[model samples]
Target: MNYELICGLETHVELSTKTKIFCSCSTEFGGEPNTHCCPICIGLPGTLPKLNKAVVEYAVMAGLATNCEISPVSKMDRKNYVYPDLPKAYQISQYDMPLCKSGWVGLSNGRRIRLNRIHIEEDAGKLVHDRGNTFVDYNRGGVPLIEIVTEPDLRSIEEVQEYVEKLQMILRYIGVSDCKMQEGSLRCDVNVSVRPVGQEEFGTRAEIKNMNSLAYMAKAIAYEFDRQVDLIQSGEEVVQETRRFDEGSGCTEGMRGKEDADDYRYFREPDLVAILVSDEMRKSIQKQMPEDPQKRLTRFVSDFDLPEADARLLIEHRRIADYFETAAKGAKNPRAVANCILGQMFARLGTEAEKEQFEVAVTPEQLHELILLLDSGKIRMNLVKSTLEKMLDTGKPAKEFLSEQDLAGMSADDLKAVCEKAVAENEAAAADYLAGKEKALKAILGSVMKATRGRANPQEAEKLLADIIRR
Candidate 1:
């Protein structure tokens, strides 16, 4: 029997706040092992926890961006657990009263992935194992986090990937979290199960923990789906448990039995007061949200006449989108601006780091000027490419580089002279063109372009070459 995969994601996003959630300790990553911690963060005997106002604000911002309803009042609870990474032996998190609820994120195909809740919590410490020795680092113990729990709305691996990417883009665009997977800022717990296609009830689900890579998450989900289906087909029972993906083996290994919510022994925290989001606060945050990426993409396609693929690529990077908008404002043809950005501008960004850094040498105004030049037929496409390279290297405007290098397009007289020289040199090609060999004109145009050092206008030079060949 064929089975359908059902999947849900629990994503933990480390807020970009300057300090830990409950203490004044630094929230910066990769600090000296326990140096960034303190009495409150490491859970000392006499310390009391104080919530960070910024953490709450950022969480609300994220919620608003995702269309989540902000809770007027929410309180924190103690999640009782014992682990080496938990210095406090009990985590302070939201149990029944989370900060936001009932939200949805839209996928590319117009499907909405429903969100169960988004809760604010403190991150646990790290456990470092090296060569049979184990070390605990408390630096990350109290880092502020917002856990976004989604419903089992995703049906396939591709949908899961798209949902994650769109969520990341929204969070990043709102400036709440960087969502850097490599640095552990954004991490996901995937819950997957497989059931017969027509079944109403869900299957025994397995949870995969701490998958930081999206590509690997896709693989792990696929493997888990297959594993569950195989067990059901072969007269074996599928166990509900927690698993870890082994990247080297490309499969998941069982870690431990899954624990239900009651297993955590949650209780209300007495020290901190409940969160209260006033109407003014919510309105302010809602106003602060920029236009959503999807809306911007739609506007780009409609207003600028950009292809959907090109518009999608442009809006993926917020900075690039901003730059494109600024440059496009002054451009005669917005499509040309899109082409230059997607083609010439992207060519200069060689590495992922460079793209992430997004340090373009040319300003939007300068790029607009370059596009205008191209639009006005002042410079050929080939010279525009060379000019862009020089602009990237020197951080100079295109016009300045073109003027300094004398790379301006050749005049009509100069182009005709070069075409004449090409005809005299390539008599066979010229004779073939006169004898109605239309393709031979390409050779003549190439010769003219070469003679003029790529400064000749291609269209004008083609006309000039035809005239010279006919003569």
Candidate 2:
């Protein structure tokens, strides 16, 4: 019997707030191991926790962006668990009273992945395992996080990847989280199961914990699906448990038996009061929501006439999208601007860090000027590329690079002279062209562009070359 895979995700996103969720300690990524921790974050005696207002505001913004229903009244609860990373012995999280619920993120294929809830919580510390030794770092402890839980609506690996990417784009666009997988700012726990093709009930599910990379997540899910199927074929029961993906072996090893909701012994936090989000507060946060990435992508395709692929690339990063719009504004050809930005400009920037630090290198005006020059036939396309490189390297404008490199297109007199030289040099080819060897004209045009050092306009020079050789 054919088996169908069913998967859901629990994505944990670290907020970009200035301080930790319940403490004033720094939430910066890399620091001395335990230095960022304080009495409250480290769970020292008699220290009380306070909620960061910015955390709530950011959570509400995320809810609004994802079409979630913001909970007017929510509260935190204690999840009791013992681990090396969690210092509090009991984690303060939202069990039943989550901040956002019943949301959905739309995919490019027009499928909607329904969200169960987006709850606020604190991040646990990191565990460093060396040779026969283990260490815990509390730097990330008490860092604000929003756990986005999705319903089991995904059936394929492609849908899961697309849903995660779309959700990341929305979160990043709303300025809630950076969603950097490498930095552990964004991580996912995938719950996967396989059932018969026509089965309504799901098979025994395995939860893969803390998958930080999307590529690795796909691999883990694929392997786990096969593992479950193999077990069933062999007549062994598929046990429900927590598993950790082994990157080296490209498989998953069982971690422990999966715990149900009652296993955590959840209860309301006695130290903190319930969070009351008023209607006015929700409206205020909603007012600050930016244009959704998908909406902007649609507008770009319809209004700006950008191809869907180009539009998707632009809207992947909010800053890059904003830069494209600013440069395309009032330009002769917005498509040209989009192409240059996506093709040439992004090629030069190279890395994400360089792209983030890119505002100083090329301005919107400079890009617009480059497009204008190309459109007006003032510079050849080759010169335009070199000009962009020079602009990036020296942080200069396109005009400066064009003028400094003497890259101006050859004048009509200069071009005609070069074409004549090319014809004189390739007399046999010129004669062949006159003799109706039409392909000979292309050879002559190459030589003219070479003689002019690629400054000769190909269209104008071809006209001149054809006219010269035909006469």
Candidate 3:
């Protein structure tokens, strides 16, 4: 029997607020191990926690972006657990009521993942377990985090990956959080179960803890799916517990006993005041949201008349989308801008070495100008591409390189002159074209372009060659 995969994700995004959730400690990543902590964050005796107003606003903003309803009032509760990371014995988290609820995120496949709730919480410190002794780093102990939970509507690992990616993009676009998985600013926990294809009852689910990257999550899900299938096929039953993903082995191992909701012993913290969201505050936060990706996609297609795929690629990166719009200003060919950037510029990014090299080159604006130069025929396309590489290597402008190398587009007169010479140089090509040989047309054009060192536009050369061929 074919088994269907059911998956749900609980993702935590650390808000980009200047300070911690309930303390004045810095929330910045990569600080000295214990220096960013304060009395309230480190759980010093006699310290009381005060909620940060900005955290609530960011959570509301996130809610608005994700189509979640902002609750008028939400309170903090203690999640009691004894772990080395959390300096405070209990993590201050939203338990009974979250700041937002009843939301839905739409997927590209036309599936809607219903959001159960979104809540504010303080992050735990880091525990470095080495040499049989665990050391605590309290730097991240009280950082503000927004936990977003989705209903068990996801049925496949691919769907879960898509949901997390879309959510991350939304978070980044709204400026609520950076959502960088590498820095632990954004993290995910997945709950997965499998049921026979036609069975109504759900199988026992296992919680996969601490998947750092999207790639790892996908692989872990596939591995777990095969493992579960084999177990059930051999008459073994799956268990419900927390499991850890071993990056080395690419498989999950049972870690420890899993705690149910009742194990938390949750209760309201009397020391902290409850957060109340007013209508005005909600509207204010809503207005601050950027043009979401879906809306931007539609506008780009309508305004620029770009293909849906091209428009999606352009809008995928906020910087590239903005650059496309800006470059199209007073320019006729928005499509060219999209193609050049996505085709050429985007291929050069998203790597560590490339990122370091990019810092030493011209900005995106300069590259946009180079495209304009190519479109206007002020510079040849080949020269523009080569000069871009030079600029990337040496931080020089394309225009400067064009002037230095004299790779400007050949003038109409110069191109006509080369076309005349190319036709005269090869009698067989001329004779073949006159005999109605279509392939000879390309050979003649190639000769002219080669003679001009590819500085002449191929279209212009082709037109000139056809005119000369008729003579």
Predicted model with the maximum TM-score: 1
lDDT of 1 at 142: 93
lDDT by residue for model 1 (71-168), tens: 99999999988888998899999999999999999987879999999999999999989999879999999999999999999999999999989988
Candidate 3: residue 203 Cα off by (Å): 2.7
Candidate 3 stretches greater than 4 Å from native: 231-236, 258-262, 347-416, 428-443, 450-457, 466-471
lDDT by candidate, in order shown: 0.88, 0.88, 0.83
Q: TM-score for each prediction?
A: 0.93, 0.92, 0.88
The C-alpha local distance difference test score for the whole of candidate 1 amounts to 0.88
lDDT of 2 by residue, 176-262 (tens): 998989899999999999998999998889899999999999999999999999999889989888899999999999886545423
Clashing pairs in 2: none
TM-score, model 3 to reference: 0.88
Q: Write the per-residue lDDT of candidate 3 for residues 8-111, one digit (tens) a residue.
A: 88999999999999988889899889999788988988999988889998999899888999999989999999877877789999998899998989999999
Q: Which of the two, 1 or 3, has more TM-score?
A: 1
Q: Cα deviation of 151 in candidate 2 (Å)?
A: 0.4
